[model samples]
Structures are given as C-alpha cells and as structure tokens.
Target: MIEVQCQCHGRLNELLPPSRRHRPFTHRLKQVMSLQQLLIPLRVPHPEVDLALINGDSVPLSRNIRNGDRIHLYPDTGDLDDPSLVLLRARPLQRPRFILDVHLGRLARRLRLLGLDTWYRNHMDDRPIIRLARLQGRTILTRDRGLLQQPEVTHGYYMRATSPDRQLHEFLARFEPWPWLNPFSRCSRCNGLIERLPESEVRRRVPPRLYLEFRDFFRCSCCDQIYWQGSHYERLRRYIDRLGV
Candidate 1:
C-alpha cells in the first residue's frame, strides 16, 4: 500500500476534485510503481508537481515505490540554486515568444500588448501548433490538458484560470519575462510593431475633431492600424502597471 498526501498550492489543488483536495489517500500497489506512474494515473501531470517526498525523503519522479511507502507532494517552486529540487520544465526561450493554442486568443492579444511576441490563430489545429512550438522554441499556453500531454511537447502550460485577466498573472508567474518589455510597443490586434507616424501622414486615418483633441498618433508596422492616447490608453496603462510591467 502507498499512502499519498498533496499540499495545497499551485495548479495541483485546482487540478484535483473539489471533494479530495488536500486530502490524504492510499493506493495499493500490487507491484512496484514509479512516482510518474502513480501521479499520472491520478491526473496530476509532471509540471504540476514540484517536489515528491517518499517517506519524508525527497526523491526523483523515476524513483520506484515499494509497498507501504508514504508520499508527500508539494507544488513548491524548487530552489533555483539547487538543480536537484527544480521542477522539470523546458528551458524558457532565450528570446521569449509564445504560441497560444486556439483557446487563448484574448490572452494572445494581451501578451502582445505587453510587447511580448504572441502568435495566435482561432481554432488552429494541434498538429501545426505543436510543430511550430518545436520548430520555433515557442512556449505553448493552453487550457487543454491533453495538448500539454503530447509526447513531443517540450514547453507548455495548462492554464487554470478561465478569465483573460487572471491568466496574465499566471503567465507572469510562469515565465518571469527575460526581455525588457515596453507596454504598447506592439499592435494589440495584429501583433505588429507600433511606431510613431507623422501627424501629417495620419491625417486621413483620424477624424478631424478627435485628432485635434489627441495630437499624438502611432501605427502598426504590419497591419497599418492607427493608435492614439485615448481614455482607453489610460485603462491599458493601469492594467499593465497592475501586472507590474
């Protein structure tokens, strides 16, 4: 018999059934079982686990379980200085880029608003998404558990929050952005670079009275969309500031 208990933190608690969260349970192992085999069957994926202790000693996922072993699992952020305790995840991209699966179109745009290079297409098939993820070294953000389970998926996260706003918090916590991010540097609609255009050049793109009120203008490099510092700009600035960059 193997007794297991899980700590309440990270996505692990969210992944469990409401009835069983933070509860200890026992499973009988007729034969020896590795930690991976045990947890996967319980629907707790590897990325969801930070530390696995068997009989109060930390052990790797590959360590096999003998009968009567006690397990304590934690969603700990392993010590960055200690390699052994680190959670297994793909090395974050040297240059951060993300490929959002079909599920996260809104999040895709928000990431771009933060000047992060985020690629998204609505209802895109998984094969190409996976292919691009591997080919481009892009991190995959999705709500699909099965998508993260793909054998070739080297970098992926199972988004737990449903709303777009909360999802951004999860992303910041996950990747801890490496690149210097300047908000409003990218097109929110098309993922293009945004640059200032001469007021003369943007004349036709803007309404006369509105343009008179807001003299500054910017355009997207790819989509040629125009942007100005409007009331919405303040809201976006406040949103980004709330996210801490």
Candidate 2:
C-alpha cells in the first residue's frame, strides 16, 4: 500500500471527500496502476483537466503509477481567474486567426462574415485540427475542453457560450478582434477573400434581371463562388448591427 496526496485549487476541493479538503489525503492501491485508473474513482470529468504532474514531472494520463506516487491535477487555465496562466506566449502571427472545431460551425460562419479569417471544417478530426493550428499559427476555438488540453495547442480559447450569437459576443468581448473585422469581405462558405469582378465578366452567370438590377459583384478566388448584394446581405447586415459591429 502507498500514500497519495491531492493538492487542488479553488473549488476543485469540493470534488474531494469533505475530510480531504485542505489536507493531505491518502489512498492505497494494489501493485501498480495507470494515472487514468487512479483518476477514475475521483469522478472528475477527464476532459476538463488540462495537465497532471507526478512529483513535479509532467506525465501523460496513460503513464503508470507506482507505490508512493504523488499526483497533482490541474484544470484548464481558462477556468481559473489567474492571469499568470491566462497569457501564454503569442504565436508568430501579429493577429490571431482561428480554426473552429466541428461543433462551432455557426460561430465560424459569423466570424468569417465579419472577415476574421476563420477556418471551419465540419469533419475535422482532432489530430488534423491540432496540426493545422500549430503549422499555421492559428488559434483554436473549440467547445471540447479536452481538445484545448493538448500540449501542442499553444493558442486556444474554450468557448463558454453555447448559442452561436452569444459565442460570437463572448469571443469579441474576450479577444477584442475589432481591428481584424473586414465585414462582408470574405466568402461565408469558405475563408477566402472576395475579389471585385466586372458585371461584364459574370453577366452569363447571373439572371438578366439581376444584371440590370445590381451593378456590383464579387467572386471567391478559392471556391469560385459568386456574391452579390441581395436579401441575404440585408439579413446579415441586420445581424451585424445586432451584434454591435
């Protein structure tokens, strides 16, 4: 049998038995076990935890636990009001671009509509999302707390709000990406810049009535999707106004 101690922060102590709060708690285990197994009985949601340290050394959840091992677990820094843990080193980009996870497609579209250079993929796997964020120096916007816990993810924001409109407002209030807003300058379907195209160039693609009605048109260089001012534009404009943009 071996003794283990838990040093938890803030309300995390509530997760422990009443007698263990502000005190060293001991547990006995037979032979050896993995950190994952040890934590299973604690009932702490694994996704909310970001890092675990064993005797001052970082270790993975799958690491084996031995006799007399002391484990310290930490929740995501974003959950804590600690400033020291909040500001990590900025990535290479002067302005942070974003890659939205599968659950945040609506927020991604709203961000792109504001021309914030957001990348969105409904089917992006965790591995590729992390890789893209690292390679492109992009910040990850995800609702899954576990994904933000990855070590490779240096810049990430865990979305707090579930509603798409509230999520956009939350991000804006948190990051203040106002300087990056370009407004209707990007493809809502794709994160590509729209380029001006003469009416004559896309005349065949539009209805004759539309050609006579609207003089301005923009085309996406990446997906070749066309954009023109119409009812959708007015709806989006109203949304932007409601967003206080």
Candidate 3:
C-alpha cells in the first residue's frame, strides 16, 4: 500500500480526493509504481512538479514505490535542498523560448509582445511542433496532456487556464519575466523583432494622415511588417505595466 499527498500548487489538490488532499491516505499497491505513474493519471505531469519525497526522502519521478510507502509532492517552488533531487529536474534551460500549440495563438501573441521568442502557427500539427521544439531547444506549450506526457518532450507546459488573460498571469507568475520583459519589441502579428524605422523612409508607405500623426514607427525584421503606436500598442503597454516586480 502507498500513501499519496500533494502540495497546494499545481492544482493537484483539486485532482486528489478531497480527504486525500494535503493529507495522506493509504491505497493498495499491487506492484511497484513510479512517481510518473501515480501523478500522470491525475493530470499533473513531470514539468509541473518541483520535488517528490518518498518515505520522507527526496526522490525522482522514476523512483518506484514499494508497499507501505508515503509520498509527498511539491510544485516548482525552488526550495529543494537535497543535492540528489536536483538532478531529478528534467534539465535547466539556457533561456526560455517557446513553441506553442495551435489553439494558443492569442497566448503566443502576448508572449511575443513581451519580446519572448515564441513560435506559433494556427495550422501546425503536433508532430511538427514536437520536431521543431526538439531541434530548436524550445519548450512546448500546450493544453494537451498526452503531448506533455510524451517521453521525448524534455520541456513543456500544460495550460490549465481557459482564458488568455488568466493564462498569461499564471505563466508570468511562474516564469517571473519582469526582468526579461521588453514591451513593444516584437511583431504582435508575426513574432518578429521590431526596430525603429525612420519617418521619411516609410513616408509614402503609410497613410498620409498616419505618417503625419504618428512619429514613432517600427518594422518587423522577419516579415517587413510595419508598426506604429496605435491604440493596441497603448493597451499592450498598459498590460505589461500592470505586471509589477
């Protein structure tokens, strides 16, 4: 038999039986079971867990549970003190760049607006998303549990929030991007770098009224798309400002 308990973060508490949440309850263990086996079925993947302790000792996801063992799980809180458990973390990244799933176009746009490198396509399929993510050292962002559970995915995030606003807040809270955020620096449409373009250079390219009314202009490095500080720009700036350190 095994006793399972989970931390408050990751919404894992919701998935557990109410009486079992934040507390342990014995369950029959027919055979040895790994941490992945227990949590994956509960919809919490390896990417979301900070640490796992078995029998009051830090253990990895591959650690097998024996009869009469106790288990505890924590979210990515960075408080783990055991040196051995540190290796249990899939791997740390040099930096966080992303490849988002088809349904996350709005979230992709928001991430790119903060100058975070995010690859997104409305028509892209999972195979290609996985391929590009692996080849480019990018993290896969999806709402697909099966995809996140795949063995090949070294880094991924499963979006729990349905609304884009809440999703962004959740993501920002996790990544703590206040230091990295660079607003109005990427194409909201194409995820391309935006740089200042002289007014005279685009004088004839823009509407005459816009050319006269707007002095600040930027162009996308990848798509040659143009941008000016319009209402959308102001709104996004306000959104970024709302995220304080």
For each candidate in turn, the TM-score is 0.76, 0.68, 0.84
- Candidate 2 lDDT by residue in tens digits, 79-175: 5564333222333367769999999999999999999989999999988999998898788888876676665666776787899989988899868
Q: Which lDDT value does model 2 have at 85?
A: 36
Clashes of 3: 0
lDDT of 3 by residue, 18-95 (tens): 766766555654566787776666666676676777777877778776766666677654654655664444676778
Model 1 C-alpha lDDT per residue in residues 94-148, reported as the tens digit of each score: 7888899888999998999999988898968888998998898887888887776
Between candidates 1 and 2, which one is better according to lDDT?
Answer: 1
Going through the candidates in the order shown, the clash numbers are 0, 0, 0
In candidate 3, position 178 carries an lDDT of 72
Task: Report how far off residue 84 is in candidate 1 (Å).
Answer: 5.6
Worst 10 residues of 1 by lDDT: 1-10
Clashing residue pairs in candidate 2 are none
Deviation in angstroms for 189 in model 2? Answer: 0.3
